[model samples]
Every structure is written in structure tokens, then in C-alpha cells.
Target: MSVEAWTTVLVILSFIVYIYIGWRSRVSDTKGFFVAEQGVPAVANGAATAADWMSAASFISMAGLISFLGYDGSIYLIGWTGGYVLLALLLAPYLRKFGKYTVPDFVGDRYYSNVARSVAVVAAIFVSMTYVAGQMRGVGIVFSRFLQVDVSTGVVIGMVIVAFFAILGGMKGITWTQVAQYCVLIVAYLIPAFAISMLLTGIFVPQLGFTFGDIVEKLNAVQVDLGFAEYSQPFANKSMLDVLFITIALMVGTAGLPHVIVRFYTVPNVRAARYSAGWALLFIAILYTTAPAIASFARYNLIDSLHNKTVAEVQQLDWATKWENTGLLQFEDKNGDGRFQLTPEEASNEIIVDRDIIVLANPEVAQLAPWVVALVAAGGLAAALSTASGLLLVISSSIAHDVYYRMVNPHASEAKRLMVGRVMVGFAIAIAGYFGINPPGFVAQVVAFAFGLAAASFFPVIILGIFDKRTNKEGAIAGMITGLAFTIFYIVGVKFAGMPTWFFNVSAEGIGTVGMILNFVVTLVVSRLTPPPPADIQALVEELRDPTHHVPIALTDIGEEQLD
Candidate 1:
């Protein structure tokens, strides 16, 4: 089959499989919709968790970012993956033991305040929306290429498919479908990487080939010849502070994300939660390790194809000509010279390459089979669709369970709540589709904001709620307010006002590191000043500290007893 035909077949096959899983696993009750009735096995949940966590950012953007950034990209690999360690050890099992449906449930009951739960809900909504927008945008990008349609049309198509699964099946449906997505995406990602690896170095392993091949050395020599720095050099273009704090923000932020944390809630028990985290990390590490290898291979091939070639000659190259039509790769005869030379000087090269296109374009750059290119298109969509479905569930559950049932109508029936949750899923997906049509920025940039916000608003408060028994409602509320408000202010200031100077030279992406520290300080100071939480709430904390015991009933009842 032709490339277009193969792309159509692969994408349709993956979608049919996912839709079938969603239909088979559809949930009727609130418990099943919200947390899969806590019946998922550890290994299955782990695979689902890996799919949920590896959004378009990991699947499509990480390799592209690394292709351009060189060793500085290690911050993303380390920061993104390291946070799973924190989640597995510090938070996942304990939260699972708490036996609540949502993160807000823990916050509200732990602090013995509805106001705190409401705050967490708002934060969850914000974090999930920000994250989902990027996922939808990624979906649109892949679909635009796969279906040969416009991005806006692709986004609409993607939104409809997501709504079908997320609105009907909820978490149970999403979980099983995501397990299938993990298989599709991971296999799709690995094949092209292994093919490119073998082609470049006569080795099947991309990671080993990346380090062992003479290709990198040759690329480095080309960089020197072109007056640009070596591609393998550390911190080639970024500041040390940018790398340091961004890594920290992303690491802690991963632990704070609502969708990812909620994955732990699907496991059968506290022990399963812990085991699931380990398995999830192991699965994620497979792609995380291979991404750099693909990045290196693509980077080398891209530079090799362009260096010493004239603009006219470059226009004739199949990969360059193909991507140029998409506006992701552009060339101009600046300085009136036809030759292309990628030097440090802006005018040295005639090409302007969009970093986002690296992975999608990698197969073509390597002159791989057309079918491999089609598979890559399908893989990118799987990554985006899986994560988008998970985030949509988080957004809907926060509104239906946390806001409606928990806060507004405590007497609401499970059926009514499930309907409301489904409605909210449809509503949220529409909003995300809107953003995808008119994206605020690239997929990775929007995701960075999501991480920064989650790190600032949730990470410190959740840690304190678990570890600090004396941490009261007032302190937790004050901390979230400070963190959320200040982080948004910093992001707005840097992005809109062009505020050039930041505290300690931290970039906008790394400002969450600072926001987290301030949250901890404000929380501590406020907790010391306020009266301690009631005896019952304090006792509940003690109960949560031991993960060996599972609390099947609602924690809200425990909080209400103190009030009564």
C-alpha cells in the first residue's frame, strides 16, 4: 500500500481497537466511572498509567526538543521521569489507602473543610484543562498529517472520538483503552527508532548505536565546519539556572498532576498502587531512554542533509520539500547566497526548522519505508488521544463527584452523578477542542505551563497534608492561594508584560520551583500561627500514614463526625 493508504489503515485500526475496548468496558455506576471500581490489576493499571502519563509531550515533542537542545534536554528526561519516583514512594500508596475518588476528596477531608476541597477542585480543573489543550493540539497535528486535512478539522475529528469513549465509559473505559494505546504507541515509536538506528550504525539498539556510532562524531565535525557548537555538548545554548529549576519544577510537577495521581486510585489496594507505580515507571523509562537516541539520530541526519547544500539543492531534497509544504521547514536566500550553512549567526543559514516536526519528519529524513512513516503518524495520535481521554475524565470527575455530589447535592444518586459526569466530559472536550484549534503555543510549551501550575498549587499542599499532622485547613488554603496566584502572576508577567528579570534569574518555565518553595514557607508559617486541626482529623492523618490498612468507606464521614 501507499504511504497515505497505510496511514489510513493503521489509524483506523488503532481507533477501532480503542473504541471496541471502550464499548466493552463501559461503566454504568459512579464508582466504576470515577475509579474503575478499584478493580484494575497492578500490571494492567501500570500499563494504562504509562499511557496516561506519556502525553503528546513525551510522545511527539520530547525527541524534537532534544534534537535541537542537545544535552540540556536531559533535564526533561530526568525531571519528567524522576517525578515518578516521588509519586511511587511519597504519595501514590498513601493516597490509595485514603480511599477517596479524587485528590480534592483527600484535601477536603484531611483538612476538615469543604472550602479546601473546593480549592483543590478548582486547581484540578485548571491543571487538567491546561494539560488537555496540549493533548488535543497534538492530536490535531497528527490527524492533519494522517488524514490530509486541516488542523482545525483534525482537532474536531479528534474531539468527537475522545468524547465517544470518555463520555460513555469514563475511567473504566479509558483505562482499558489506554492499555491498548500503550501497546500501539510504544510499538510504533520503537520500530522507527530501531530502523533509523540500524540504518545509521548497523546496530538494532538505538541507545547503544547513538553512543557507539561514528555518526555523532561526524555531525560534531560538521558543526565545527559550520561555525556552530557541537551537537553533543552539554548546555549548548541554555543557561544553567534554566536547566536546573525547570528540571525540578517538572519533577515535582509530575507528582502533582491530577490525572496521573488519579491513576493510583484505580488499583485494587494500597499494595497494588505501589506495585503499579513501579511498573508504570519501568514502562515509561523504555521510551524515555530511547527518545534521546532518536533525537541524536534525527539531529545528525537533518544537519547532514542540509550542510553545504544550496537553497535550490535543499528544495529538491524530498524530506525538506515535503515538510516545507507544511510550513514547519522554511528556507530563504538570506545574504543572497544560495548555499546553506547553519552557523551561530542568524543569516548564516537559509533554513528555519520548527522543532516540533523533528519526530514526525524523522522517518522521511532517514528515507525509511513509507509504511513506517504512516505508523509514526498513528503512534503520535495514540499518545495524544490516550492522554486526552484521561485528562477529560479527571476534569469531568472533579465537576461531577467533587463539586456536584460532594459539595452541591450530597443526596444525588449515582445514576444522576454519572449523567452529570458524562455531560461535563462532553463540555470539557469542546473547550479543549477550541484551544486545539487556536493553540496558545506549541504542545510542549503549553504542557510546561500545566506542570508549573500543578507544581505550584498542589505539590507542596499535598506533601504537607500527608507529612505534617499539624498542618491545618487555614494553612493549606493559604498555601494553595499563594502558590497558584504567584505562579500565574509570574507566568503572566514574563509572558505578557515582557518582564525580563526574574527572581534568581529563573525562567518562566522554572518559576514553579520558586513558587513551590514559597508555598512551603507560607504553609509552615500559617500552620504554626493557626490552631491545630481537630483530634479526629489528626487521627485520620495517622491512619493514612500506614498504607497497610485500606479505608473502603468515605473519608468525608470521618470529617463530618468532628463537625457534628
Candidate 2:
């Protein structure tokens, strides 16, 4: 079969499998809808969480970013991988022990205030919406190339598939489908990586391929000859301070992502959540370790196949022509030289390729078989849809459970809540689809914005709420509003409004670190000015910290104390 034919077959099979799983795992009650009744096994939950966390950014864009930025792209690798450690050690177990349906549930009960909960709900929506937009754009990119459709049509198709499963099965459906997606995405990812690695470096292991075969030296030499910085050199684009800030923002942002935090709630207990976190890190490492190798290989091939080639020769290449149709890759004979140029200067450069397409186009550029190309399309879809489904759940659960049930009408029935949750999913999908069709930036850049938003809005309050016994409702409310608002204003001004990067020259991508600092400082200062939390909330915080099974409050003469 041709590449498109094979891609059509594989993509259809994957979608059918996803829909069948969603039907089989359909839920009736709100508990089943929200947290899968807390019945997921540790290993299974780990796979689901891995799929959830490794969105389009990790699978399609991370390596692509590396291909384009070369060594400067390690920030994504370092910050994203290091974040799992924070999630496992600092957040997952404690939040799991709280035994809530969502992150806002914990914030609401811990701070003893609906206002705090409302702020968290809004933050969740903003972060999830921002994050899901990237995933939807990824889906559109895949369909645009593989299915030969307009990106807008592809976005609509993705919205339909995701809404069906997410609305039907909720958390229960999304979890199992994600497990299947993990298997599909990992296998699809590793196969091409192994093939390309062996072809380029004569090594089976991609990590060894990039390290032992002198591929980096060759790429560096090629890049330098083309008026670009050596591919292996660091600080080619972003400064050292900007790198540090972006790295911290992504790290804290990963740990605070509301969708990922909710994964621990699907497990049985704190122990299970811990096990799930450990397993997820292991699964995620398999891909993270292989990305740099693929990036190096892809960059070398792209330059080798196109640099100084005639316009007619490049136009005859099917892969290059198709990507151009999506407006992602283009070629022009600048200066009427009848040949393409790969120089760094924008005026003379005749080839324009979006970094987001590097990974998807790698196999085609290398002239791999049609099946390999098709499998990559399937994998890309799985990665995007898995994360999109999870984020949609977060948005729906925030509105239906956190705002509607908990605050608006505690007396709402289980069926009504479930209906409302499904309705919210439809609404969220509509919004996500719109963003998909009209994305603010490429996949990785847009996802970075989401992480920065999460870092600013949720990380400080969540950590403080867990560890600080005296963190009152006023402090939590103030911290969340200040953090989210400050981060959003900076992002909009710098990215959309052309505002100067006047704050220590930190780019909008790294401004979340500053917002996080402000959140912590404002929270502490406000907490000190206000009265402390009630005794019950304080006792709960102490109990959560206690290692024993039970810790009761004891009266110690003048002041109340915790009995460990």
C-alpha cells in the first residue's frame, strides 16, 4: 500500500479500538466518572499517567525542538524529566492520602473556603485549556499530512473522537484508552527510532547510536559550515539566565499540572499512588532517553537531503510537497538562483520548515518504508488524543464537580451531576477545537505557555496548602489570584501585545518562575497578617504529616497540640 493508504488503515484501526474501549468502560455514577472508583492497579495507572503526562509536547515537539535548536533544547528534557521526581516525592503521596476527586477538592477542604476552590477551578480551566490547545493542534498536524485534509477539518475530526469517549466513560474510559495509547505510542516511537538509528549510526540502541558513532561531530561540522552555531554548542540562542528560569518554570509547572495531579486520585491509596508515580517515571524515561538521538539524526538528514538542491528537485519530493500543503514547510528560490539555501540569514534562506514538522517528516526525509510512516501518524494521534482526553476531563470535572455540585447545589443527584459532567465535556471540546483551528503558536511553544501558567497559578498554593498548617483561606485565595493574574498579564503583553521583557529580561516563557515567587511571598505575608486556620484544618495537616495510622489532637494546658 501507499503511505497514505497504510496510514488510513492504521489510524482507523486505532480509533476503532479507542471507541470500543470507551464503550466497554462506560460509567454510571459520579465516582466512576471522576476517579474510576479508585480501582485502577498501580501498573495500569502508571501507564495511563505516562500517556497523560507525555502529551504532544513530549512525543512530537520535544525532539523536534531539539532538532531545530540543537543543544539549547535540553531545557525541555531536563525540566520535564526532573519534574516527575517532584511529583512523586513532594506532591503525589500527600495529595493521594487526602483522597479527593480533584485538585480543587483538596484546596477547598484544606483552606476551608469556597473562594479558594473557585480560584483553583478557574486556574484548572485556564491551564487545561491552554495545554489542550497544543494537543489539538498536534492532532490537526497529523491528520493534515497523513489524511490529506485541511488542518481545520482535522481539528474537527479530533474533537469528535475525543468527545465520544471522554463523555461516555469519563475517567474510567480515558484511563484504559490511555493505557492502550501508551503501548501504541511507545512501540510506534521506538520502531522508527531504532530503524533510523541503525541506518545512520549502525547501532541498534539509539542512545548508543548518537553517542558512539560520531553523529554529533558530523552534525556540528555541518551546522558550522552553514553559518549556524555548532549543533553541539550550548547557549546558541537563549542566554544562561533565561535557560535557568525556563527550566525551573517547566519543572515546577510539571509537578503542579492539575490533570497529572488527578491521576494519583485514580489509584487505591497513597502507597498505590507512590508505586504508580515510580512506574510512570520508568515508562517516560524510555522515550526521553531516545529523543536526543532521533533529533540529531533528523537534523543531519534534513540538511543532507535539501541544502543547495534545485527547486525542481525539491518540488518532486512527495514528503516535502505534502508538508508544504499544511503551510508548515516551504521552499522558494530566493534571489532567483533556482536552488534552495539553508543559511541562517532570513533574507537569503530559501527553505522554511517549522520545527514541529521535523519529527513527523524525519522518516519521509530518510526515505523509510510506507508502513513506518503510517505507524508514526498513528503514534502521533495517540499521544495527542491521550493527553487531550485527560485535559478535557479536568475542565469538565472542575465545572461540574467543583463548582456546580460542591458549591452551587450540594443536593444535586448523582445522575444529574453525571449529565452535567458530560455536557461540560461537550462544551470543553468545542472550546478546544476552536483553539486547535486557531493556535497561538507551534505545539512546543504553546505548551510551554501552559506549563508557565500552571507554575504561576497552582504550584505555590498546592505546596503551601499541603505543608503549611497555618496557611489560611485568605492567603490561599490571594496567592492563587495574584499568581494566575500576574502570569497571564505578562504572557499576553509580551507574546501578543509586544510588551518589553523588562523584568530581569526574562522571556514570557520563563516568567512563571517570577510569578511563582510572587505567589509564595504574597501567600506567606498575607497568611501572617490573617488569623490562622481553624483547629480542625490544622489538625488535619498534622495528621497528614504523621507517619502513624492515627494522630489525634490533644489539649496541652493553654494551647491545642497534635498527639502523634
Candidate 3:
């Protein structure tokens, strides 16, 4: 079959599978829509969480970013996956024990203040929207390439598919569908990676083999021949401080992401939460390990093919013109030469190659059949759509459960609240789709902003709420405000105003790290200065530490007390 034929079949089959899962698991009440009625098994929840966490950024762009950035890309792999370690040890179990539907609920009750809950709602919405926009853009790119549609059409189609499943089954539908997506996306990601890995290094494990031996040798040889620094080493011109800052920023940002933190809410118990984190990491590792290999192989192929080749020659090839039309792959003849230079300087030119295309382009580079390329296209869509669905759920739940039910209509009927939720999902999808069509910046760069925001705002409050008994509402609010303010100021200043000469002067690469530090520091200081939390707040903390304190009930059976 032709590549387009395979892509159409895969997309159709995947959508059918999702609609079937949604139909099978459709729920009639708010509980089923929000928390899967807390019935998700650890294994199932783990897979769902992996799908939710590994958005288009992980599936499509990470390898491309790594391909260009080389060893520095390790920051993303280690930072993102290592976050599960922190989640498993520090956050997930306690949040599960607290037994809440959303992060704001825990903050509201833990601090005994509506104001605290309202702050969390704002933070969640900001983080989720920013993250969702990236997924939408990823969807558009995949559609434009394999489906041969415009990006705007692809985004709208993606939005419709996400809304269909998210509205129909809510959390219940999303959970099972994501599990299926996890399977499709992982297979899609790893198959080509495995093929390329075997061809390049003769090693089965991409992660270990890419770093340890044969691949490094090849990279060094390529660098020497191209008159570039050895790819096996870090960039020689970059400062040590810049490297340190970027690494720390990425790590803290990973630990701070709200969508990732919220995944724990679906599990039934503390132990289950711990086990689920393990499962999520294992699933994520399948792709994470494969990503570097894809990067190495693609870089090798791109250089080998384009080395010393004229732009006219490359443009004459079908792949070059096709990619150029999509605005993904581009060639510029510098030095008034007709030839396309594959040098670092050429690759670094301001006219960017879309990072998301790296994975999709890998199979073609390897001379794989068109069917494999088509499978990769489907896989990219699956990754984007799955993550978009999860974020939409978060957006809807925040509006319905947090703002509408809690603030707007305290006594609203469950049915009325659910209706509002569904309406809000449509609105959110429309807004995100708009952004996807007219994306303001790079998809990966926008995602990094979201991560930085989450790290700054939510991470501190959740940590203090879970670990410290004395943290009062005053402290939580103050810390959150301080963290968010500093992060935004620093990011905006660096991005727009240019880095100030007198600032701590660490590379802006890790500004998120600095913001997280400020958040932690401010929280600790404010908590120490403020009076201890009320006695009931302390009691709530005790209750959250014990999973056996309450019985597990079907989501529909949950009362206000359980949800509150």
C-alpha cells in the first residue's frame, strides 16, 4: 500500500478503537467523568499516565531536539524520566492517600481556605492550556505531513477526535483510550528506532549503545570530517554555568508539572500510586531510550546524504521539496554557493527545521518502506491526540468541578454541573485549536514554558501541603505568588528584554531552576513566619497519610465529603 493509504487506515482504525473504548466505558455521572470512579488498577492507570505524560513533545520532538543539540539533549531524557522518581517518592502516594479529584481540592481542604483553592485553579488552567497548545500543534504537523492536509484542518480534526472521547467517557473513556494510545504510540516510536539502531550500532538497547561505544566513535569521526566539535562531547563554546542551569531548570520543571502530578489522583491507594509511578517510568523508558538512537541515526543519515551536495541537487530530490513545502525541512545556500552545507553553522541558521519532524523523517533516512513511514505518522498523531485528550480533561475538570461547582453554583445539580463541563470542553478545544493553527513559536519551546510555569507555581504548594503540617494558607498563597511572579519576570525579561548584565548571570537556559529555588525559599520563609495551620487542617493531614482510613467506593458513590 502507499504511505498515504497506510496512514489513512491507521488513523481510521485508531479513531475507531478510541470511540469503541469510549462507548464501552461511558459513564452517566460526574464521578466517572473525573476520576474514573477511582477503580483504575495500578497497571492500567500506569499506562494511562504514561500516555498522558508523554505528549507530542516526548514522542515527536525530543529526538529532533536531541539530534541537533547532541549530548545536551540528555537533559530532557534524564530530567523528564527522573521526575517519576521524585513523584514516586515525594508526591504521588500522599496525594492518592488524600483522595481528591484535583490538585485544587487538596490545597483548598489542606489549607482550609477557598482563596487557596482559587489560586490552584488559576495555576492549573494556565499550565494545562499552555501544555495543550503544544499537543494541538503536534497534531496539526502530523496531519499536514502524512494526511496531506493543511495544518489548520489537521488541528480541527484532532480537536474533534479529542473532544469526542473526552466528552463521551470523561476520565473513564480517556483512561482506557490512553492505554490503547500508549500501545500504538510506543510501538510506532520504537519500531523504526529499533531498525535504525540495529543498522547503526548493532546494539539492541538504544540508550546504552548510543552513549557507550560505536555511535560515539562515528559521531567523533563525523565531527572531525565536518570541521565541527566532536558530537560525543558537550558544546565547547557554551559555559559550564549554562549547562548547569539548563539541567537544573529542566529537572525542577519536570518535578513541577501539574498534569503529571494529577495523574496520581486516578489510583485507589498510596501503594497503588507508588506502583503506578514505576509502571509509568517503565512505559516512558521504552520511548525515552529509543529517542537518542533515532537522533543519532537521523543526524548520521542527514549528514551523509547532504554532505557536500548542492542545494539544487538536494532540492531535485522528492523528499527535499516535499519537506520544504511543509515548512519542516529547509535548505539555504550560504556563501552564495548553490550547495547546501550540512555544517553546524548551516543547521543553526535562523530558518528552523521543525523539531517534531525528526521522528517522522527517520524512517525515510533509513530507506525503510513507505509503510513504516506511514506507521510513524500515525504514531505521531496518536501521541499528540492522547496527550491533548488528557489536557482537555484537566481543563474541563478545573472549570466544572473547581470553578463552576465550588464557586459559581455551590448547590448545582450533578447533571447541571456535568453539562457545564461538557460545554467548557468545547470552548477549551476551540481556543487551543486556534493557537495550534497560528502557533506563536516553536512547539518544544512553548512546552518548555509550560513546564517552567508549573515548576514555579504548583510544585512548591503541593510539596508543602503534603510534607509540612505547619504551612498555613497565608504561606501557600505567598509562596505561589512569589514563585510565579519571579518565574514570569525572569522568563519575560530574558526572552524579551535580554538577560540583565547583573542578574545571577547563570545561563538563562535554566531560569526555571532559579524560579523553583525562589519558590521553595519563599514558601519556607513564609511558613516559618506565619502561625501554624488550624487544628482541623492538621487533622486533614493525618487523614491523608492513611489509605486504610476510608473505604474505596465507585466513583458514582462518592459523596461531597469524599470529593471535598
Candidate 4:
């Protein structure tokens, strides 16, 4: 069969496997839908968490970004992984111990205010949507290339597939399906890297290939010869503070992400949550550490193929012609020298290398087999779909459980709530599809914005709620609002409105770090000025702190339905 045919077959089989798993694991109750009945084992939950964390950004676009950005891309590595540590040590165990269905459940009950809950729900929905939109776009990109369809059609297909698994099985279906996805994606990602590694350095391991052979030195030599900076040097031309702040922002944002943090709630107990985090990091590190090797390999191959070659010669290369059709790679001889120059000024053709194409095109670029290329298509979809389903669940559950059931229809039955959650999943997918069809920016940039928003809005209040008993409703609400407003304004002004610069020259991606400080300061001052939380709520916080204490009923059960 042809490459496209093989790709289609592999992709179809993957969807079938996921749909089957989801069908078998279907849930009927609100608890099952939202938290998978809290029965997931630590190891499985860890795998699911890894799937949830390694989204399209990590799988498809990250290597591309690293390929181009070189040292600057290290921020994504450090920031995202570091955030998992923060989550394990500071947030996950406590939140899991608190045992609410959603993040808003904690915020509302802790503050003893519906208004506080509403704020958290809004924040959750907003952050999840932002994150999911990027995932949907990722789905579209992968499907479009493999299925030979328009991006919009690919997005619609993605929506239907996600709705099938997400609405059908809820958390139970998604979690197990994610385990399968993790296996598919990790294997798919590693194979191409390993293939390229052996070709270049005769090394079996891509991670070891980086330092084991002459590949790194050759890659850097080629890059410098091409008039670009050395690929191995850290802090090449970028500002140190900018890199530092972006890393910090991403770390906090990773911890603050509702969808990722929600995974811990699916595990059985606080111990599972902690252990799951460790396993998650181990799984993620496999890809996280290997990505740089792939990036360097891809960069080396790309430059080697094009440099000192004529336009006609380049056009003859199958990979070059294939990518040029997508408009992601182009060639023009401006000086009519007939040869492609690596330097920017002399190079006639504008090589608008869309950062996303790096990973998806890596197999073709490295001249790998058709099967490896097909596997990449499947892997990309798995990465995007798994993350999308998880985020959609978070958005839907927050709306149904936190907003509608908790506030509007407190008398709603468990069955009714479960149905509402499923419907909301479909609704959320539609909205995410709209954004996918019409992305505001690149997938990574848009996702980074979501991270910043999450960092600014939820991180401060959540940490304080756990660690500071004196923080009252007024303080939490004020902090969330202040943090969200500043972060949003800075992002909008800089990204959309053409604001020249922000405080400390921090980019929009890192501005959340500044917003976090504002949130902390406002929350501290306001908490001191306001009355402390009621005695009962304060005692509840105290109990949550004591790891030995038996978890209260509120933490373990679906909250009692309140009357209107």
C-alpha cells in the first residue's frame, strides 16, 4: 500500500482501539463520570497523567520549536517538568486529600461562598478552553496531512471522535484510553528518533546519541557553517532574565492547569497521588529529554540536505517537494545563483518553516521508512486527542458539577448531573472546534497563553487556600480577580493591541510570573484586613493539613445537592 493509505489505516485502527476501550469503560453515575469512581491505580493514573501532560505542543510542535530556537527552547523543558514537582510536593496530595469532585469544589467550600466557587468555575472553564482550543488545532493539523482533507474537516472529525470517548465513558473511559494513547505516542515518537540516531551516529539510543557520538559536534558545525549560531550553546543570544521568568511562569502554570491537576483526583488516595506524580514525571522525562536529541538530529538533516544544492536538485528530493506543497517549506533563487544558500541575506527563497512541521516531518526529513511516517501520524493524533478529552472533561465537569448542580439546580439528581456533564462535553468540544478551525496563533503560543492565565488566576488562590488558614473569601476572590485581570490585560495588550513592551520586558508568556506576585501581595493584604474564615472552615483546613486525619465526607463524596 501507499504511504497515505498506510497512514489512514493505522490512524483508523487507533481510533477504533480507543473507541472500543471507551465503550467498555462507560460510566453511569456522576462520581464515575467526573473522577472515575476514584478507583484508578497509581501506576495507571501515572500513565494517564503523562498522556494528559504530553499534548500536541509536546509531541508535534515542541521539537520544531527546539530545532529553531535552540537554547531558548530549554525553558519549555525546565518549566513544564519543574511544575510537576511543585504539583506533587505542594498541590496534588493536599487537593486529592481534600477530595472534592472539582477544583471549584475546594474553592467554594473553603471560602464558604458560592461567589468564590463561581469565580473558580469561570477560571477553570476559561483555562481549559484556552488549552483545548490548541489541542483541537493540533488534531486538525495532523488529520489534514494524513487524511488529505481540509483542516476544518479534520477538526470536525476530531470533535466527533473525542465526543465518542469523552461523553461515552467520562473519566473512566478517558483514563484507560489515555493509557493506550501513552503507549502509542511514546513508541511512535521514539522510533523515528532512534532510527535517525542510528543513521547519524550508529547509536541505538537517541538520548545517548546526543553525547555518545560526533552527531552533536557535526550538527553545531553545520549550523554555524550555515550562518546560524551553534545549536549546543545555552543562552546564545537571548536574555537570561527573559528565559528565567518564562521558565518560572510555565512551572507555575503547569501546576495551576486544571486538567492536569484533575488527573490526581482520579487516583485512590493521597499516597496514590504522590506516587502517580513520580511515575508521571518518569514517563514524561522519556520524551522530554529525548526531544532535544530529535531536534538536533532534524536540524542537522535539514541543513545537510538543502545546503550546497541547486533549486532543481532540492525540488527533486521527495521530502522537500512534499513539504513545499504544504507551503511550510519553499525555495526561490533570488540571486539566480541556482544554488540554495543557508544564510538569510543571500538566500532568495523565503523558508517560512512553520515550527509545527518539525516533528511531523521528521521521519520524511530523515528518509525513514513509510511505516515510521505512518506511526507519526497516529502518534500526533493520540497526543492531541488524549489531552483534548481530558481538558474537555475538566471544562464540562466544572460547569455541570460546580456551577449548575452546586448553584443553579442544587436539587438535581445524580443521573441528571451525569447527563448534564456529558452534554456539556459535547458543547465544550464544539467550542473548542471553533477555535481549532480559526486559531488565534501558533499552537505553542496559544497554549502558553493558557498556561499564563492558569498561573495567574488559580495558582495563588489554590496554594494559599491549602497553606494559609487565615486567607478568607475576600482575599481569595480578590487575588484571583486581580491576577486574572492583570495577566489577561498584559497578554491582550501585548499580543493583540501591539503594546511595545511589558514590565521588566517580560514577554506575554512569562508575564504571569509578575501577575503571580501581584496575586500573592493582594491576597496577603486582603486576608489580613478581612475577618478569618469561619471556625469550621478553618478547622477543615487544619484537618486537611494533618495527613493522618481521616478525610472528611465532603472530600470523598459528591457534594450534597443544595436547595434553591
Local accuracy by lDDT, each model? 0.86, 0.90, 0.78, 0.87
What would the C-alpha RMSD of candidate 3 be, to one decimal place? Answer: 3.3
Q: What are the models' TM-scores?
A: 0.96, 0.97, 0.92, 0.96
lDDT of 2 by residue, 248-338 (tens): 9999999889999999989877888989999999999999999999999999999999999998888899999899999999888878888
Off by over 4 Å in 4: 344-349, 550-564
Model 4, clash count?
A: 1
Candidate with better TM-score, 1 vs 4: 1
User: Considering lDDT, where higher is better, how would the candidates rank from best to worst?
Assistant: 2, 4, 1, 3
Better of 1 and 3 by TM-score: 1
Model 1, TM vs. native: 0.96
Off by over 4 Å in 2: 550-564
| TM-score top scorer | 2
Query: Candidate 1: what lDDT?
Result: 0.86
Backbone clashes per model, in order?
0, 0, 2, 1
Worst 10-residue lDDT window, candidate 2: 555-564
**Please, what are the lDDT tens digits per residue for candidate 1 over residues 20-74?**
9899989899989989989999999999999999999899988988887887888
